[model samples]
Target: MKVLYNHEYPRRVRLAAIGCGGHAIRNVFSTHPYAPIDLVAVCDLDRERAEHTGCMFGAKAAYTDYHEMLEREKPEAVTVVTNYDEDGRPRYPQIAIDCMQAGAHVWIEKPPAASSAEVLDMMRVSEATGKFVAVGFKKMFFPANVKAREIITRPAFGSISTITARYPEALPPLEDRQDLHKMWRFLDHIVHPWSVLQYLAGPAESIFVQRSPTGGTVTAIQFASGAVGSLHLDRGQGSSSFLERTEIVGPGGNVVIHNNTKLTFYSDGPKPAGGYGRSGDYYGGDERAALHWEPEFSLGQLYNKGIFLLGYAPEIRYFCQCVLDDTPPEVGTLDNALEMLRIYEAYCQPDGQHIRIDTEPGKVS
Candidate 1:
């Protein structure tokens, strides 16, 4: 298929995919037609599923074993989106290392590893083989989240004073946390909120949390940037409830992302005098003052698709672009994975204790 580009379509990257499961089938495979990737093969533990996906996506072959797929296909890149093991462990680290060793860049799903040690091992292999591993920390790629990053970095936003992130998830109690099986659900999902906080606020200096009897928890985090933040895990919330709402407050202005898609920027407006009440005017400034973006379901637009708007497609495009350009991914890099692991480890211990993270240099320490 011919790949389209804004200016000129560059050479598409040959790709092999691992794990033909629900996420891969729904999001990743659906994105191939839009990205600069040529899907050459699909592999899964289930031979039937792999072959089905391969036939559906026009892959040349399918295999039950990823190693055989990698050895035979020798594609430039691979996408790993398998499920966790019975022990609540991620199974992609070894597969990713194998792919990197075979001279292919890898893009794996979240919770890059079951532990920090696994990620370090993959990092070592990636460095030794001169290949890259991009974890799908898709929150960093969300259009609203990306815009929030830009807003916080602007001089006018000043030094980010605080951030508040709300996601519908709960952490296991401290006693149960020791068991990877008990904590598996938390470990798998905590990366979502952690990625958002780390991307916008920098590394967390310390964390203090309180868990509820029913399994909900609230964590207060202090960033190395000297910015404070809060994470609220709503355990009892309905699954149909809005999953995310984030806000970043700087010296003057602030940005709020409603439901993970609508972004609103409240720029610095003139303060009222002592005698004056709230003004009637709702509009803040000219074209530059207020900005917002949300999909109009009424129209047939690419933005309406979950693949494009929900961060999966854009993230795949990002990895493909990095490979074609021979550049390291800014997001989903090993360093980001390390930071996320640190947060996961911190939560494993008891709450109300401070755990300091060693952040990278020049990062507002």
Candidate 2:
């Protein structure tokens, strides 16, 4: 709970950043104030952008070449928030591998790689170098997701049996799946919901997708834990509409998250006194009734800020915590990123054709 200013945490992990784009400026760099990190350097292909981000984010130096920055700064860790390459592959996997080879732990934004194979390669390098590589699967760290996890994992919720998520994203035609450029949108944003789903329900054992004429698709999933799940891709929704919704159901209880912030947990409702129609009251006591949470704009609190509420700061804090504790990250590890890639791949398959995924730990090969 200690909020240490960047300058006040000189003894914290010496860290540098690669990519001075909008996501880094708005979400990642702003988190330096709270995380256990020293913003020592910033790097980007564009010198002006890199220099400006360095000055803006309290970094001591800036460089055009990430290789030079990594070698010269010798930072204990590096954060990468770069975009995709010209071919539409995420630039992070290779850059992350390079950072680990340079003896620095890495935190990169998703999608971690263009394909599961690339993630597997990153995993090999991370293992060989003994440096941790964490992806910024920020949705998994959202306050709502964290609370839903807490609710479902609790003894009162019994065993989680089903999950349903609705997200606004389009699925490219199957013919274009192999072309990275054609599938860029699918590869990029699909990780958001898939990461959250995997966080709550370990991994999907089998998946079957149904496509729509409007480009959206609905996917049915069977989790490894005997849980059935569904992901509805609503590409036709208006931009003003809420983009994400998730519901996790267990024995006699359920949790629902709407628009990524508002959460309602309906704990087991009272049993019917005699028959279903014989119940006298619909509401339970305050403690037994559903609980709801959302940020109030009236308060000038950090929790009200999107950087925190959207989970950017906490994700950075978790990465810093892994470095300080000398432990590999549990949530955003390369393994989880690989799983996300597999899910994306499954969506690209022919509609209604179930694809079996290998969720077991280790490299895909």
Q: What is the RMSD of candidate 1?
A: 3.4
lDDT of 2 by residue, 104-167 (tens): 9999998889888888898899889999999999988898899889889999898889999999
Cα lDDT, model 2, residue 6? 53
Model 1: residues with Cα > 4 Å off, grouped in runs: 1-8, 272-289, 360-365
lDDT of each: 0.85, 0.87
Tell me the tens digit of each residue's lDDT in model 1 across 1-365.
Answer: 13354224468889999999988899888888778877899998999999999999888999998888888889999999998888779988888999999999999998888787787888888778889999999898888899889988998789999999999888777789878888878888999988999889888888888888887888988898899999998888886888899999998688999898899998786543333465555453474466777777978767777877789988998899999987879887888888888789888887777777767521211
* Model 2: lowest-lDDT 10 consecutive positions: 1-10
Model 1 lDDT-worst window of ten = 1-10
- In model 1, state the lDDT of residue 174: 73
- Cand. 1 Cα-lDDT: 0.85
TM-score of each: 0.93, 0.96
Q: Identify the leading candidate in terms of lDDT.
A: 2
